[model samples]
Target: MTTPAAADPTPTTGRRAVGGMRALTLATAFAAASGYLVMLVAGRTLGPSDYPLFATYWGAFFALGGVANGLMQETTRAVRSARVGPAAVLPAPGTGGRVRLLPAGLMLGLVLACVVAVSAPAWPRLGLPAFSGVGVAVMAVGILGFSLQAATAGALSGTERWGLYAVLLTVDAALRLGVAGVAWWAGDAGLGFAFATVAGTVTWAVMIALSPATREALTRAVDVGRRRFWRNTASAMLASAGTAALVVGFPVFVTATVRESDPAPLVGAVILAITLTRAPLLVPLTSFQSAIIVYFVQRRELGPRALAGPLGLVTAVGLVGAGAAWL
Candidate 1:
């Protein structure tokens, strides 16, 4: 008969899995809290009266932001999957890949411009004069800048640089939080909020540039041909857009349909409620996607029956969350 030690092959895998989860839990918590804090500060600063405009732009950002997010998730999965083999070091995603990002980013920028152009004529007629001509301009700039930085984020994800990824996310939140705080204090709440939105994104992108991992990734060559890269990126972006729309589309729609006397108050209330309610559920889900992907990759490394406990815990958490949401 085989002894217990000899029979088991995944010796230390169990510990790694558990330890990974513990560390990820902390990162996810910081990410989640910091994210929601931005919303809280924005809500307090903008107030319900003017918040609907911000909500509209916020929703639009998500809709447009989907491309970057999709790219990041797929890259992460692809990179991590590739590294599961015997190779000790995976090829760092090359620098040339970023040249490809420029066109994609430009395309997104054009889309934003077209959106603003189309909406400009209708905005003032819809009692959104302030937002139509100039407010929309700020939104476009902010979203464009945010989307431009997505490629770097995708590179970070694929390389399994979890610590750097977490730091990037945390800093993004912190920057947004700081911007919101400053806008609120300055009492230029209306325009300042939009400026803060843009500033935070620019700051996040700048911070990521300063990262050693980012610089390293930038030095590498494109892993695949242009045709194949865009093809894959397109599908990933479609899915990402769909997911982001599910979260923000309703707010955008509501704000769009609100009547002229600046029905921002009612629309703002809805946006805030949805934002607050969705945070606990969605933030953790988004934050954990990479970790969950890694978990699957490491499945065979885990001990016998190791997954059972974690799976059970996840199921229990789901049930509790669902019940609470229902209540």
Candidate 2:
């Protein structure tokens, strides 16, 4: 017979954990919704011509950013979790926190250059070069910025401060949308709109750099031994760059192949359909990836449940969006 006092903590703890999960889910959903609404408004207002270039440039940016950021941050989280048990790790950085920023930046630049070189031939054919060069440069900057943000977010996730991460993401998305909206309203449709995105990324990066956790992380990296730090950072960069190519390369191929025959407007419409389809799934995919990292870190096993949920959501979203496009 368990004592009431003993039994009370189990349910209470369970309730708290459940509540936290719910909050994370809601926050992610809200952020995704806000992003989608902004896209919708931008799409409607800008139409196919304007939106496609923006979308194409953005897609390329994110694909690259995701890979670079994902690899570094994911590796960092895993290493941190292993060194300090997940339960004991603090959400904020402390002395001896591990990250190699400069090497990672260089590797990211190299990868970006390679990606650009591989895709350069098709840019002119697709009319993408008109907007792509500056877009790529901006995206390159964004990749570095996002890598730092992801590192900070990864630390927060390790400590189960996902709610805080979600808040930061929501704020980031809102700021991005607001800036783009203002730019578009001011009659800066194509490249000007793209510049707004660059501004947003810069703003977010500055905010993250100013954050206490991020500042601490940088301080810790200083003592984490330059040699070992660069080694790990390089490995993570390669893995992330590969992952980015896998994700974004397909679209570049598609645009290149399609643009040879299709007009720019038609190409843009197709891209929009793909973008909208993927939009809803981004939230769940992010949640799933974060959950997997945490689960793998703690249990030393993959979370099939998390992986399955996102796959199902993505499949459903793809089907619905495709159908809408066809109609």
Best by lDDT, which number? 1
Q: Worst 10-residue stretch by lDDT in candidate 1?
A: 1-10
lDDT of 2 at 264: 66
What tens-digit string does per-residue lDDT give for candidate 2 at 41-110?
6677678766766666666666766665654455445434533321322223443444454344455556
On a 0 to 1 TM-score scale, where does candidate 1 land against the true structure? 0.75
* Candidate 1 local lDDT, 1-327, one digit each (tens): 111111111112466445545555776787678667767777887788877767766666666665556655555554444445444222344512333443555565566556656666776554355666567787677666666556555555455555555666666666766777787788765666666665655744665457666655433333344455566667887887777877755566776677667466777887888887787887777777766655665575676665786689889999998898799
Per-model TM-score versus the true fold: 0.75, 0.69
Whole-model Cα lDDT of every candidate shown, in order: 0.61, 0.57
Clash number for candidate 1: 3
